[model samples]
Target: MARLVYQPQSPLNATLAVSKRWATSLGIWGVGAGTAALFLLSVTPLVKREFLVKVPVVGSYYEDKTPASDKPF
Candidate 1:
């Protein structure tokens, strides 16, 4: 008679395996959503000042180039 080997599966192991499988997909979705959100908010003053203006390549594009004396308030 051949003996059967039983392996115990832990919940932690199951969770880790699932997370590993989905990690890349989840990361891509998150990054895409974040970039979309930033673009949608690009017209907002707060978003431009706090985030867009800090981006090295596009910072100058978002910067307020108008002189203070323009006086629109």
Candidate 2:
């Protein structure tokens, strides 16, 4: 014979349950915001060196091919 245990859900569980309903929408919005941020920051050297340059397909596109000596500044 097995005894049944009753467990009450906490507020955190309730919040998580509600959030599950909006998960897909939230994910889409998050991705859109991140993409917009990346695009807006794309011209910055930090973003270019740290992120855009590591993207596989377009990595070569962002690579700086110029020799250091060729730069005027």
Give the candidate number with the greatest TM-score.
1
TM-scores for every predicted model: 0.85, 0.74
TM-score of 2: 0.74
- Cα lDDT tens digits, model 1, 11-58, are 999899999999999999999999999889999999999989999998
At residue 18, candidate 1 shows an lDDT of: 97
- Model 2: clashing residue pairs? none
Q: Candidate 2, which ten residues in sequence have the lowest lDDT sum?
A: 57-66
Candidate 2 residue 42 C-alpha distance from true site, Å: 0.5
- Segments in model 2 whose C-alpha atoms lie over 4 Å from true places: 1-13
Q: Which tens-of-lDDT digit does each residue in 10-42 have in candidate 2?
A: 999999999999999999999999999999998
* lDDT, residue 28, candidate 2: 100
